[model samples]
Target: MRPSVCLLASAMSSAKGMSPGPMALLPPIHLYRRLLRAHRKHLPPEMRLLGDEYVKAEFRAHRNVENPVHMIGFLTEWQLYAQKIEGDAWVGERLDPGKVEKMSDEQLAQLYELMKAIQKRGTEEGQDGS
Candidate 1:
């Protein structure tokens, strides 16, 4: 739900006959947000944060500032944006995971940082065959 993503959603909502179904929604990225708004009330626990009818469906608010998911979306998109801005330095875009894996150790470390930034893994360490 980055500002750009919100704005994208807003645009979709404003257009006439923009049904909240898979077919009507051309871009899957935009469709993702609309579907959330269309079914906000019934969204599962994991998706409720992205479901805001008023903010996204009503006037199509330019991003839901209150939604925590938006922050994650912003950071994820920002990661790509940063790499894009440093285009020359970024040897491989996020689009090329295979190339990314073969990147230098420094690039690998940077990618790891991006992966860990929003990670929410529960510490479940357990003893194996010791």
Candidate 2:
């Protein structure tokens, strides 16, 4: 419906004898979000930590920028943070990448399981609350 309306509008304008160049469909913000969703799967293994919610938050934070390209810097930061599974929290608390790497494979696997369980519980609680 929307597309038909747009086409009708454009056709009317053309009937008035004006040139119809290409029209920009989605705005910068919408395009930004679509690009993020499209490429999330392409992110490296560790960097996938910053999931949908995290990306949405970052998108909100970058909303002030007129050009969406400015969001590249914010996205880079998010990627780096996500990749640091063993890094310090935003402040100075020690995050030992070496320590995480040195852990036994079983320990690492268990930790991954724990993270999944915690995420699932959190999601359930949020749904229940609402």
Candidate 3:
């Protein structure tokens, strides 16, 4: 079994709660490490660079979060992303419309910036491709 899957199973099997799931099972650090490992194993160099930095920044930003709802949402999204990366299913995928609709203004702005950055990188690579 994959490390993340094992972690999830361990978390669930040990749970005594009413609704134990991914968010309630895996700890933040374990998920963070799993993501980093996935990126290292699956991503190209350029993507790994960007993904690693983004993951570090995000984890650092959320280090002190006290709200369970927010923390659950944050961890759940990252966990899904890790699974996607591990499964080699992330390339060329479009953002989900439902997820976009649920985003706050700040999150939307961040997504816009990420889009612009990706476009800029593609343009630069195209120009250099000769």
Candidate 4:
């Protein structure tokens, strides 16, 4: 058995009012660490920093949550994202024009701004290197 599974089993056995289930049987901190490691290997430096910060903030915000249902949802989403990153399924900042057309004006504006910022940073770096 995986160390996480063992830890989860031990935790469930000791905690009152908590039963073993698939989600509950996966140790979240272990999973989070795995996701971070995967990100380090798969993501570009800027994107990795952003993703790591976002994940850290979200986990910290939910650290005190006692609702198992919500916790499971959060873990499931993050796990899927990690899997996508590790599988090389993510292409950075490249949305289809058709999909962009479907976005709300505010969303489009935000995406445009982000793209511009990334481009500007790249330009600045190129200038610095020369």
Tens-digit lDDT track of model 3 for 4-23: 54454456547676574544
Best by lDDT: 3
TM-score of each: 0.21, 0.28, 0.82, 0.56
List RMSD in Å for every model shown.
13.4, 16.8, 5.4, 8.0
Query: Per-residue CA lDDT of candidate 4, range 1-130, in tens?
Result: 2344445444764677766454433457866797899889998887677668767877777676666555655676677677778898876535567866878897678667767866886787799999
Ranking the candidates on lDDT from highest down gives: 3, 4, 2, 1
Superposed model 2: Cα runs more than 4 Å off? 1-95
Tens digits of per-residue lDDT for model 2, 12-112: 43554566533323433444455465446454433344445445655565556544333443444344454343243334455468867877897588568
Off by over 4 Å in 3: 1-13, 17-24
Residue 44 CA displacement from its true place in model 2, Å: 33
Taking the candidates one at a time, how many backbone clashes does each contain? Answer: 0, 0, 0, 0
Q: lDDT per residue, candidate 1, 43-114, as tens digits?
A: 454334422432244224323454544443433443343334334343343466766666889757755764
Instruction: Compare candidates 1 and 2 on TM-score and give the better one.
Output: 2
Q: Which residue segments of model 4 deviate by more than 4 Å?
A: 1-25, 92-130
Which 10 consecutive positions of candidate 4 have the poorest summed lDDT?
1-10
Give each model's whole-structure lDDT.
0.43, 0.50, 0.79, 0.68
Q: Which TM-score value belongs to model 3? A: 0.82
